[model samples]
Target: MIDLLAPELKIVFCGTAKGTISARTGSFYANPSNRFYRTLHETGLTPERIDPAEFRRLLDYGIGLTDLNQVESGMDRVLNEKHFDLQGFREKMLHFRPRLIAFTSLTAARIFFADRTIRCGLQDRAIGDIPVVALPSTSGANAHWTRDRDHWYQLRALICRAENPSWGEEQKATE
Candidate 1:
């Protein structure tokens, strides 16, 4: 799968692998039940709701998209360890150096970190100098496991701070 990436992106969302629907459509998070695009707009990550087919347009908003298992398209359970290309993922992040690498699901974050105990939020870890964040799975199947979208909001706020250092003060003044 071709990655939607560019240098100096604010966030690069990394998922475990594309689903069958996404692979077929040649788009990231093409599954309608997946709330990937909706969440972006809802969390104020993007100015408007973007269609999955137009995913490449996300670069305009300083967002990029990629998956761990590029050669396979399926859920985490259906995929094997060898399918995940951690080295390739590292190379991309090192080369492009996005400000943040946010995993679309906790499962993806755990796999990349090689630590099963990792939780959902901005972690104390780094993929080199870049920070890593974990968000809830927007998959319809995992709907029961999600508590709320606060983690995503926190991520967007962090990105906002990076974009505008005085964002917090501006927000306080507005309130």
Candidate 2:
């Protein structure tokens, strides 16, 4: 699948690799059970729930998408170290410079971090100055983690704050 990337995007979502459905459909997150587009809409990132085939439209909402293992297409269990391209991902981040990078699964983040123990929010380490985060996989196979939407909400809040300095001030005042 083609990467939907551009310069100065607010956030870029990175996944482990394309699943069979996504690759077959030539779209990002094409599996009907994937929650990626739905969660984006729920968190106010997108005005509407977008279909996976319309993945390019994400750039209009200041979001981009990519995969760590661009050459492979399958579940994580079937993938190995050779399938991933850490240097390529790093170079892409440095070049495009999205404000934040969100790994769509812990497995993807772990692979990127060189098997280091990492968490589900923003990390201390960054690709140059761009912040990095790990979100629960939106894949149906990973429903246990996907059910928690807090991290996704926090990401929206962070993006809002970054774009507008006074964001959430009214909510705080009312509270």
Candidate 3:
């Protein structure tokens, strides 16, 4: 699948690989049960819930999408390690220079970090000064992990703060 990326995006969500439905439809998070779009809306990252079919519209909202294993299309267990080009992904991040890079699933983050202990949240490590975050998978296939909105909300706040340094302060004042 073609990566939906551009320079200076607010954030880029990277997945391990395309799920069967996503690959078949040529859209990111194409599976009906996937919460990716809904979470973006609920976290106030987008004005409304975006349809999976119109995934490219994410660019308008300052969001980009990519996959670690671009050559494969399946679940994490089925993806081949050789197809995961971490260096290429890093190079892309260097070129695009998004404010944040969020791995859509902890598995994807683990693959990128090569550290299975990496948690699902902000990491101490970064790629060329760009912050990295790991979010719980929105895939229906991730039955082992419970779905959580807190991380997604945190990501939104981070994006707001990145865009405007006083955004978090203003929010706190309002509260």
Residue 33 lDDT (model 2): 86
Which candidate, 1 or 3, would have the higher TM-score against the true structure? Answer: 3
Q: In model 2, how large is the Cα lDDT of residue 113? A: 92
In the range 70-104, model 3's lDDT, one tens digit per residue, is 99898889889999999999999999999999999
User: Which is the better candidate, 1 or 3, if ranked by lDDT?
Assistant: 3
**Best TM-score goes to which candidate?**
3
- RMSD per candidate (Å) reads 2.8, 2.8, 2.4
Summed backbone clashes in each candidate are: 0, 0, 0
How do the residues 86-144 of candidate 1 rate in per-residue lDDT, one tens digit apiece?
A: 99999999999888899999899999989999888888988887878898888887864
- Tell me which residue pairs clash in candidate 2: none
Go through the candidates in order and give each one's C-alpha lDDT. Answer: 0.89, 0.87, 0.90
Worst lDDT run of 10 residues, candidate 1, spans: 141-150
Model 3 — which ten-residue stretch has the worst lDDT? Answer: 141-150
Tens-place lDDT digits, model 2, residues 53-172: 888999999999999998889899887779799999999999998878999988899999985688788787888877788888888887666456589889987676545646678669
Write down the RMSD of candidate 1 (Cα, Å). Answer: 2.8
